[model samples]
Target: METARSQQQTAPGAFLAFARFALCGGGVGIASSFAITALAAWMPWSLANAAITVVSTLLATELHARFTFGAGGRATRSQHAQSAGSAAAAYAVTCLAMLLLHQLVATPGAVLEQIVYLSASALAGVARFAVLRLVVFARNHAQTQKPQNPQQPPRRHAVAGAAQGGLISRSESVEVTLAS
Candidate 1:
């Protein structure tokens, strides 16, 4: 039942979903890059980048959980928890990959190193979108098939003893006048 047309109409199925994640990720990346660069100025570059990755991943997970997938009512505390877990794993992977790439290429210059780190982080962002969209915020498609009950008002009953009163007792059977 998921046609291309339907998919196009849905926010998740649209490319904007990825773009939305990317935009939020970009803000996280900027904060990360600034932190990394500042730390690198005083300490080892690798350590700085690693620290930034850890911190930024946490921030990005919460932002994405609140903003990106929230349109479909998929933003829940459990989803944020899952995103945080995934971001932690992804952070480690991203840091290791960037560090390895930098060591292998022998690029110690700040600018070049940052460029490489950003590229690696960009790849990690793609992985994040995949995991978050497919696993974390994924809605159950099967639940939509069940029949739904229409809204109805509750029934009122008249009590024998309360015939003069406005209220009726629950223990007694009462005549309920039908309203036109």
Candidate 2:
């Protein structure tokens, strides 16, 4: 029999999960792009993008968990902390990848930098979804119980009427019946 979890691990669910992540990230990306573009007028593009990504990631995580994943309740501190840590790690990866792309494809007076950054960030969002689904979201700490180990055995005890001397003289054998 297939369990719910097993079913959810299938390709359809994986696609759905990726779609959800993309939608969430798309919403965040739009906001972040706007902010970064505005800020880039006065600051370096990388710095502006970095700041916007952080803010956008926080917003995206919250909205994604609630709307996409059907998460309930006000996020607990631990949950927020976990998401924040995940977002930071994901953001760092995204920024680094974007920077690499910028260095590779960039030229003076070219407007392709932002496009490259967006693509790289989208790829990073895909990576982030994979990690979050497999690592963070899959682990339901509250519901799952750890399996018991099977290798440990109980201590042996002497059977009743077992003689330590092991002497077998003529003796009457009695048959005992057990009732179920």
Candidate 3:
């Protein structure tokens, strides 16, 4: 059916959107990791990581709206808030992983710490993608896109017949139909 074909086409578009989102998210994570590493030299590791996470999350949120979700200038305030919430979730995951890693290896070297951070970020990326695609942008995209099939107004049909006094009697009925 036409509906099935249209849905098949939409599936590919959704996949492509997810692919773009992952790529952009990965790039942002890498950049943020580098910034965090640099900042760690001057500040406490946790403080540096937190500061970079906030800035990078804001930047990534905007980038995701513009490029990943193709929302561009049309992204709503609520959508942006959702994006920020997703980032916060990812950040929490990363931080927790870092805490666990530090617990296991009490005094990890700088390189080891960076490795742990990047690994945690990669895991968090998957969560971020799911939240962004399924929660933040899904409904908005569906609402903005036109429906595959639209319902047409009901049609009226009339029939006329001769009456006893040479007057015409008319009967009318409504027919409902769907547009392809």
Top candidate by lDDT: 3
Task: Report the lDDT tens digits of candidate 3 across residue range 64-140.
Answer: 77778765445677887887787777778778988898899978987887788888888888888888878886765
TM-score per candidate, in order?
A: 0.61, 0.61, 0.69
Question: How many steric overlaps are in each model, in order?
Answer: 0, 0, 0
* Tens digits of lDDT, candidate 1, 68-128: 7543443566766777776676667657876687768875677776777677778877887
The most accurate candidate by TM-score is: 3
lDDT of all the models against the reference? 0.64, 0.59, 0.70
Please give the distance, in angstroms, between residue 165's alpha carbon in candidate 3 and its true position after superposition: 57
Q: After superposition, how far is residue 14 of candidate 1 from its true place, in Å?
A: 3.5
State candidate 1's TM-score: 0.61
Candidate 1 backbone overlaps, count: 0
Arranged by lDDT, best first: 3, 1, 2
